[model samples]
Target: MYESCFYFVINMSISGSLVILSLLIVRQIKIISRRLLYVLWFVALIRMLLPFAISSSISVFNYLSGLIKKLIPVGNLFDANFTVSNYFNAALSYSPMEYKTQRFEHVFGISSCIWLMGVCISLIAIIVIYCSTIRQYKNAVHLKDNIYEDKTVLSPFLLGIRNPKIILPIGLDISSSQAVHIIAHEKTHMQRMDNLWRIIGLGTVCIHWFNPIAWFGFFFFLNDMELSCDEATTKTYGFAKKKEYAEALFSIAGNRQNKNLIHASFGKSDTKSRVLNVLAYKRLSVFGIAASIAFLLLVAIMLLTNPKV
Candidate 1:
């Protein structure tokens, strides 16, 4: 009952946020590929798999086991029984009285060991990146109402956690550019709540906590998002104006002198891919979009409603 309730709350929080995000995507900003958004959603699922504690310390026991097995002298070395028993005791703080539980945990062999180690690594990476990203985000300055304010001009990232606002440097002004397509591009991120997507991707790192596939999924989703946003910008402006958009992309990217931790600047290292995808936009048939939508919905429904977990 408690688990059900907990899962329900998590589900509600996630769903509610997504609904708000989708509404913002529709009304406030434009997006190209909805399919890409779904891929990001997958990355997010991988991130939030388990809590921090269990995943965090999997590596300690793993290392201890390896160290003892490899480092102990042949005559003085503790054999498997002593080593595993000691590890269980140390990792779980088990008392000699709790022999049954200790035995069970100690008896856990290679497969569980490998899986747990993977989880710990994934969790650590996710956590480290998350904190770093937060610090970066907090550093960028937010601009108040100016003529540029109407254009949704986000500043380049600044440094550190405190007093971090998006920095609109002296010469590099996105809001003032002749190509208005850039505004739609960044606004699409805000409207779709790309920050939440980032959280999800990071969360997957925590969940899978060890899978390279999860990291790949995150990058793929991010790239797709950029591509989708590019498509939307093209649709809003026009395909023939690709060079203008490309030039604007170049300008925004070229001036990124500031390097902050992770506030997710408008144009980051993704500058090249974003420009390349804009030039590569191809019109999809009604059937393609429909099928992709169906796939995403089906996967989401199955994962969400399945009772077994």
Candidate 2:
């Protein structure tokens, strides 16, 4: 029994440590250390799978050992005690009776310690980033109301903490050609509640501090969001407006200077991929839309399976 419990604790810790190691390797050595990450994945799998197999085998072995002891003619000198050794002896730490409870309590500690460490790291990151964003937002200036006469204009660091307001240079009138597309674009972002997702995503990462899959999942999620938004904006305005939108985007991107800690209002740094997705996008067929919805549902299932922190 003692040996089995020890095995389970070891197995669980290895499972957890490998998850953390995968993230650290990605951060530190980039692709050079990723092969080791694959090995870690295999190690994690074995650690998780072995316990049930080993427990079943050990239980059978223990039964056989007990049976063998019973079959023998026992004398004081020939005594064969097969009792599993209690890890805690009164001579060491606990009273003899306490060992029964202490073994399980010990295993539980391993999980608690791991979760605690993750929590600590997450809290510190959240606090730091939160403070930084607040500082930027406080320092931002409010510019005059923008009127789109169907022209696009490049603006600097436009942000609105409350209400609809564009923060750019004073006495500027964006061309009617560009203003129409730009207004539609920025307003769509505000309407979709994307700014809320930025906050929510950051908070979630804190809780899931140990999962590497979460990071990649979030990166692609954000990128796809931009691509999808671009698609919607372009499709609504029609293909004729693509050049105007693209040019506006390029101009803003060139002048875009975000606060050090705040998420960019326009899009992230993957402009090349965003440009490709925008240029390549074709109108979705009914079947294609249905298939895309089905894929989203499948991913939702995996997310639902995870126990929320």
Candidate 3:
């Protein structure tokens, strides 16, 4: 059990870094649908969370693991008992007595305890932030059905998990058309259950807070989510309103503050890129759609499956 926990964290860290590098490559391709990218990130999130994977002959992990073993004389790269502390101790020729007790297995047990401490700290921080955000909006004024006007927030966002409510800023000079677009966008987020995905991503962060790539990948994943929502809203409202939607983003983004963390806001942090994606949005050709599906399947197989060595 001790070894299992350590290896799970190691695998998650490696897989997350791979996902980040892969997304960086994929983002450079302009012809692909943004919606497809959203799905790909979700798969990456699941990849980071799971420990066991299906084995394939052509798996990327198999080849990469073999190359890593050849390049670095790390102690038993695939050993169940191998851990970060052991790897460092072997590489550096030094061991901290506190961690490396009399018994060898105690090293891993100590390392696992440290890793778990980080996870607990991350989860507690998230809970505190979530509770604080909820408390700030406790006095929000109810507008029309299910919508509330709050002076605390700059942009409109959806709050709550079970009975999710839409909260818009109090003073927005929105035309009826723009109002429709904004409402539609937030509604699409709820319809697609994006908040649940956000929570899952948060869980991933809490578990792997030590990995910088995990943090960046999760942020990029959230951006793709908003872009995907933009794609859906445009599909429903017609692509002619793309400019209007983009303008709405810019206007709201100017007022956006870095206060809330729990709510899914209408305006994203990377508003410029999102608006550009909206303007650059094109209908996927039949071949493009098919190719997109094939590419996603390929990525899923490569990242989620391990090669049987």
- Using lDDT, give the best candidate's number: 3
- Candidate 2 vs. true structure, TM-score: 0.52
Please list the C-alpha lDDT of all candidates, in the order they appear.
0.46, 0.44, 0.73
lDDT of 3 by residue, 21-108 (tens): 7786887788776788888887678767765455566656666643342112225545542222111232233445655455766777
- 141, model 3: CA deviation in Å? 1.9
Taking the tens digit of each residue's C-alpha lDDT, what string does model 1 give over 173-235? 555553345555655555555655665556554444344544555555565656666676576
The positional error of residue 147 in candidate 1, measured at the CA in angstroms, is 9.8
Candidate achieving higher TM-score, 2 or 3? 3
Which digits, one per residue and each the tens of the lDDT, describe model 2 over residues 192-224?
655555555555544444556544544544554
Q: Model 3 segments beyond 4 Å from truth? A: 1-3, 65-107, 173-175, 236-239
> Cα miss at 135, model 3 (Å)?
2.8
